[model samples]
Target: MSTVSTHVLDTALGRPAQGVPVRLSWITDDEVVVLGTGSTDDDGRVTELAPDGLEFGTYQLWFGVAAYAITSGQSIFFPEVTVTFQINDERHYHVPLLLSPFAYSTYRGS
Candidate 1:
């Protein structure tokens, strides 16, 4: 069984993106199944997006940025961000997002 997690950092504000909504989904051959949903904590971390454990396949992490932008009083080009990745083993997967109002990036982490 694999575990998945994520964190979001606001590059413009130089702080954790607290209260941001996040959703996890498993992509199957025929459909997408929602695994879990959560909001980032004060530390901008959703430490367990998949409490039920993850399988070896493609999955998506969808982040809701519009609400964050509204609260921060910033205009963003992308209201939402979705990252798709493949899980191949029983190791832990950490996906961290570096975000600004108009731009965002993600990378695999330990």
Candidate 2:
């Protein structure tokens, strides 16, 4: 089984992106399956989008940014972001995002 998590940071504001809504999905050649969804905490971490004993498959993470940026008083061009990755091993996957209106980055974390 595999586990998945994520953390989001607001680079422009130099702080955690709190209250950002995220949707976790399982993706395949055929279609996408919704795994779970949650909002980031004060620390911008969503550590448990799925239950324990997660299954291995291709997964997609969608983050809502327009509302978040607007509420935070920043104008944003990209409203939503999608990240697709494969989770095949029995280890845990932490997908971290450093984001701003003009740029964003992601990686497979610890």
Candidate 3:
């Protein structure tokens, strides 16, 4: 079993990207199964996407950025972002997003 979490930062604003919607899903050969959905809190963290343990497989984290861009009064080139990762062990997976209106970055964190 494994666990996953995420954090979002608004690079342009120099603050946490609060209330950004996120979706957690599992991907298989034929279909995608949604595991959970949440939004970033005041700290820009969704620390419990899946309250239960996650099994080994391919997973995708989708972030909704259009609303965030509108709220920030900026035009965004990419309205959404998706990060796909594989789970191969029983460890904590921390995926952090460094985001702006036109660009974003993500990395496997501690």
TM-score of each: 0.97, 0.94, 0.96
Give Cα distance to truth, residue 63, candidate 3, Å.
Answer: 0.2
Evaluate residue 3 in candidate 2 and report its C-alpha lDDT on the 0 to 100 scale: 83
lDDT of 3: 0.93
Each prediction's RMSD over C-alphas, in Å, is 0.7, 1.1, 0.8
- Candidate 3, residues 1-110: lDDT per residue as tens digits? 89999999999899999888999999999999999999999999999888897999999999998878877787888899999999999999999999987799999999
Candidate 1 residue lDDT tens string, 8-54: 99999999998889999999999999999999999999997788799
Q: Order the candidates by lDDT, highest first.
A: 1, 3, 2
In angstroms, what RMSD does candidate 2 have relative to the true structure? Answer: 1.1
Clashing pairs in 1: none
Q: Is candidate 1 or candidate 2 better by TM-score?
A: 1
Give Cα-based local distance difference scores for all models: 0.93, 0.89, 0.93
Model 1's TM-score against the true structure? 0.97
